[model samples]
Target: MKQDLRAVIIDDETNAREALSNLLRLVCPEVEICGEAKNADLGIEVIKEQKPNLVFLDIQMPGKSGFDLLASFEKVDFGIIFTTAYQEFAIRAFRFSAIDYLLKPIDPDELQAAVEKYKSQTAGLNPQQIQILQQQLDTPGTVRLVNRQKNDNQRIALPTAEGIHFVQMTDIIQCESLGSYTKFHLIKGPAIVVSRLLKEYEEILDNYYFFRVHQSNIINLEHIKRYVKGDGGQVWMSDNTEIEVSRRRKEEFLSLLSDFYVNSGKLK
Candidate 1:
């Protein structure tokens, strides 16, 4: 028989906590509401006392934020499903970190899905990946990752069968879709294969100069060594690998290339 997951809700809002608790009771029968807290400090106390299997954490709190709560622990044993009303940048950060989260005014179905995901996946969360999420959240200015300075040390967490691989975003040359899995080709090491769809990454990397020229391939604009024009055209990457561009996306790809070069002062 499957075991019940003891979960604690930690949010600044009493109503939010109550609503989540009520929803858990209504939908997820395998999850037990072990404890609840209104802020990070009390949350820390409750967590230590309860020693829950899962925590439904809110990103924004009165005193200490959700990240602050996690920072207090040297190593997190419980699973986290962040509940946030934060902006798009935070959402992107979460995805890049390979962390699970639910949006505010949460849907019952999504909550159930998150709980199931936690149950099936491994227990330990990567600290460096969490740090990457926090750094991206703290970064100011435009959300377009391409606009950011190249040396900003941006990283991403790629979850594979063995464990999670944390790699610098700049190190990625391209991503190729292999059915449900995506293969990440890097600049310095062997490619890492993740058990995730290409579209999931395409959405996040699109803002960071990573373009999906073909359905199966997403290449970094910065790593394009040369382009050969044809019906759809083809681009040679810095690693000397050739990738074809989709016919329908030809114009858009060329336009983006023009902008990329102009912005970098290479085509002034």
Candidate 2:
């Protein structure tokens, strides 16, 4: 049942850990507070000794950062829910990377959400996801995501009722807005609906060969079959879907497509 989830809090701040403990005690009764560590040295030791299922990690510590502690471990089998005050670019990176985090001063609702994600996930954050996090932290704008499910029995975690959807970025044709939700049209399968807005994906897929052609749709340039003629015209996706290209995005889309083709040496 994955019940009685053992957890350890690894933060440099005493008050921060105390506050988290209080919140967990109030909201998440299933989680057992097994241990607490002041810094990375003690954090590493705590995990080695206690062997908890979850670790509430803080990004900034005294000597070795949270990242450094993660790097020290060869394989991290426990789920990590980061508590960080890193704003703007870092947060954007986490959104695109699909890594769970709670910004400080932590929100109770957000903490509960993170715990829910932990319950759903069978294995914790692997080295690859941690690497992606580090890369995103290093290069803020690059939203290159790494998923383990291209060949293995892994799944890309999308915020939808269907839960983990096994999808590759290249296979996604376009995303259409459906009021509050977004529908993902794929090249080889039926469209999958997610409980997230188009704008959320727009930002996540920004540097990942995706562009907003209209207020309604964001198309993958690699999967674009052809561009039909009109005032603003429409883009014909490989999946036989024709998405209207907004007048404002026409020139920009074309220019980027041109650049893409040239760079790939397909424009000759």
Candidate 3:
């Protein structure tokens, strides 16, 4: 028998809080909704008391933001799955931290995926690494970045020929995989760096904004113009660049597109 994981929902919206809790109960019985809080203040207090294994955090909240709450805690013993309608700031945060999150209105499949990933990562992670990650959570300047250097696997301070290009998370048009490297196309840049593999970038970028539309391409939802119908169908970027959408990923890509447009206002 598997051990049941305890969780807390920390969202300002009561409806969203209850909805997520209900979904967890119905879809992922392994996750127990130990508590729920409407704001960061109460949420922090509940977190201290419950000491849950995981937290479903909301980026935007009344008074203090979720980022602020994370900063306030001296140590984050629990894994975080940020659920937000917005993507900009949250994407930046995820880029700096190897944190996992889901976008709203929460998808059951995404939630299940996050939980499974958390289980896999935490199951074998060294306590020293966890401590280092906790220290990173406490530090303000430490942000998540895709470390591409062969040296030490440390977070990069500057973009190198080998380091990841700091494209404004919103400005990235699409990422194309070329064997071991990925070419990132941005809104204003003509140059593309053949850096780390597509799987590496996929793990680094916020899943809410970027989706693997094909085995070779990861398209930014904000930059997608439309999906043109064809023998295999193609995804059109805001810059009018077209990329093949794999047949297996078409359904998930369409779902992400619908969510992106419907929640466009939250992008700001």
Candidate 4:
């Protein structure tokens, strides 16, 4: 009554590759292991040839790294689940990319969960959003635009090469709401003004990386330095900025933190 999902495994180590393939076949029999690649180049070739529905990607490889390989591709037709050996920065980068990932010495349960999440998210994804996600996977960073007011109309222009100032999404500490305007606090330079509501930006940002921790603040989970608990809960950003977690959003925030750490395999 269900369909089989085709998958390919890409890892430099033969043992790891085979082990993952075997595990998938054993636990998730519905997942067909189409092929395996020992390096990024070969993996890309196989992916192009097989066109599987999913890919179990390894972060590190011989010639090109997983990130490099992903960047080279113009489009990603398959869902990706990155497998790595506990690199904190890479994991954070993947989180920012809004892609599903798993830690090395992979657990069957976690792998299953990742697959399920992928299925749900991709089911109703719009073509534009898919394109945006693919673009972000290849080139990850913050986006800025200019707003112009003429008469009673407003026009927006994409930041140009001459006027362009690029900031990594991870560099964003928090977004502050002032009246109808939102100010972005970055790791460098002055905060920029954009004529958009906090809710608007929140909707644009991929939910896997950013969370609405409070009514006025949306914090990047990767930038959270610490979580301070007291009469009310608060999160400390990498820049030493504090953000309140509203009582209404407390449970959801805690659940996100729990899932993040759990998926990273810091918790059993």
TM-score of 4: 0.49
TM-scores, each model vs. reference: 0.88, 0.75, 0.50, 0.49
Candidate 1: the clashing residue pairs are none
Q: Can you tell me which runs of candidate 1 are displaced by over 4 Å?
A: 1-4, 140-152, 265-268
Residue 268 lDDT (model 4): 37
C-alpha lDDT of residue 228 in model 1: 99
Per-residue lDDT tens digits for candidate 3, residues 81-150, read 7787865544444544434568788898988888787776533222333333343344433122221111
- 1 or 3, greater by lDDT: 1
Report the error of model 4 at residue 174, Å. Answer: 4.3
lDDT tens digits, residue span 1-268, model 4 = 2256788999999889978887787777778889899988998899999988888888767788876677667766667777878554444344323345788888899888877766655342223332333443444333221111011111112122233233456567787887687778877888866655777666555333567888899887767878998655999998888888998888877887776565544453
Output the lDDT of residue 62, model 3.
83
Poorest lDDT segment (10 consecutive residues) of candidate 3: 142-151
Model 1: what TM-score? 0.88
Deviating ranges (above 4 Å) for candidate 3: 88-97, 123-268
lDDT of 1 by residue, 1-268 (tens): 2377899999988889888999999999889999999989999999999999999999889879999999999889888999998877777778888888899889999999998888887555778877877876786335354464352367889988788888887899999999999999999878999988999898767557778999999998888999999999999999999999999999988988887787777674
| Residue 249 lDDT in candidate 3 | 78
Q: Report the number of clashing residue pairs per model.
A: 0, 0, 5, 0
Candidate of highest lDDT: 1
